[model samples]
Target: MLNLNQDPQIILWALTKDTYWHPDDHWQAVDRRCKELSTGEIFAVIDDIVHHFVHAPVVILTGKNVWQREDFDQILGKMAPILPSAIALNNPRLSHAALLSRWKDLGLTSVYLRLQNPRTLHGRQTVALAEAVVDHGMRLEIMTAVTPRTLPWLPGLADLMLSVGAASWQLGFNESLQRSKLDAKTLEQTLVWVADFAATSPLRVLPIGAPQYQRIVSDRYPLLDAGRIALREARGIAYINHHGLVYPGVNLPFAGGNLRQSSFSNIYRESPTFCALRDPRPLEGRCGFCDYHLTCGGSRTRAFRETGKLYAEDPGCWNPQTA
Candidate 1:
């Protein structure tokens, strides 16, 4: 029953993600697990869209510099034949990208570049890199962090994304304690701008996390069913840290299970903590009463961040009751 066809999301820890990769025996075991997962020896079927399997298998490298680091390059080279992971690289040296030539041969189907402000120097490099990714016949995406300073630039950024032919774009607000300091007006303004821009733009632009939760609760966005939302975060998504600690999402305090203790497919399907997060009946506040409550219960991570409980409604939501 540990089949990956049901839910497939893999975040392969890279050396660049704050964790050191030592070539020790434990490291060898981790590598072996990765190979098995990549080669389908660990599960019945891995739903990878790159291989045209199903609606899942969005495997990401979880860090940048994969192209620059020799260790990652060696590991990726070995798994390239069967795995074909899509990489998300941060601030890349786009000018000297001879690596693009090997992308197809190495089974790298797409590249997602995370850019900050479009007006900044690093942002310009992002656009150039996006164009290069497209020219290489690989899919490209642009993800920008939304801060108070970065808010006003999104309109121009949307145009830039369209110009570069990126497949999608995301405006991800900070999810940590900084969210508390963020002006509510700025957050709402950013949401409205994204809602309006997405309506007009051919490029797929989306607001992530709390902004998105706001949209769903305020009837600006579609309400997802419990099953869909459950699979998406409560169960479907997996953020395995460099040490292979599997959490429901990024920077979460708890782990559903560790990949070292069980097969990834098994842990994703049957972890008690993850399963508890899926129950939609006991959702609190206005989120529990709204018919869409099952789908849009607000940001559970933000709930935990603000209220110390994942089941608590999001404090970031304008209505303390609505979140």
Candidate 2:
């Protein structure tokens, strides 16, 4: 009764917790004191990965100061024996050349950094980290939150992204902070602008939580073969918190199961929440009847955040149509 073949290609493992600063609180882990995964716990996860996906999925080790643990480099060394890894760090202090060189030596392929508000000095530091990541022969992926305060930074942000040689950029709305949230019209316009910008730039521009990006890109450039334009959340993208609880996406708080409690494959294949999310036929409102339901299932997390129902229509989608 379920399709067990939808294996995840990427997993964000938050092995540590830091103080949360971004409006999208569920998205980033930094600046706070919290529990961290132990060496044994981490290896169990790695072991599960080996036996789970058809091919090894990219694992992103993220949190405040992951290197704070003295055993972190050793952890990297252990993971190297099994799978290559990357890390997402937000601390400016940890972006120095020496540490980055060590990360490269450990077989890290990329670095993920966040730039919440690029106007401040901290924003510049975030950009500097991006440059450092590129200088060290590693891929750089920059993620930023889209708030009313950050919307105007688009042009300047694009310029900085080019200067830093970033490989990809992920932009998501600040769904946590009420005052900073974008209206439906503004969200649609922003996605369209990003879609147009992505067409000419070498950078992969992904609207983190906005599934409407798929419909916008397809409708705008119906002639070009743009490939798949959807958020790969429940459809093969997942997140795991420090406690080993697996989620459909970084922003999607619904957990499939805990790695310590069960095998990763079982949770992914049998979780009701996961199964429902992957099958968009039961989606309600505009999303259910939309032509792009297969590709753009809409943001189920955003729907749950606003309407208290997982199957509700995405508030950010502007398509006023029905089947």
User: What pairs collide in candidate 1?
Assistant: none
Candidate 2 stretches greater than 4 Å from native: 1-5, 18-35, 80-84, 176-179, 223-229, 320-323
**RMSD in Å for all candidates:** 6.1, 4.0
lDDT of 2: 0.74
Q: Residue-wise lDDT of candidate 1 within 271-311, one digit each (tens)?
A: 87667666667667655665555555656777676677777
Candidate 2: deviation at residue 63, Å? 2.0
Judged by whole-model lDDT over C-alpha atoms, candidate 1 comes out at 0.59
Whole-model lDDT values for every prediction = 0.59, 0.74
- Per residue, candidate 2 scores C-alpha lDDT tens digits across 1-323 of 12223567667777776333433445344313334667887877777777766777778887667777777887887786577577877555434656888888887887888887766788777876777789889988888879887889887898888878998888967543254478877888898899899888988787777777888888888765355647556776787777667788765667787777887777777888678788877889888889888878788877777787888877777774552
- Indicate the TM-score of model 2: 0.87
- Per-residue error (Å), model 1, residue 232: 5.3
Worst 10 residues of 1 by lDDT: 35-44
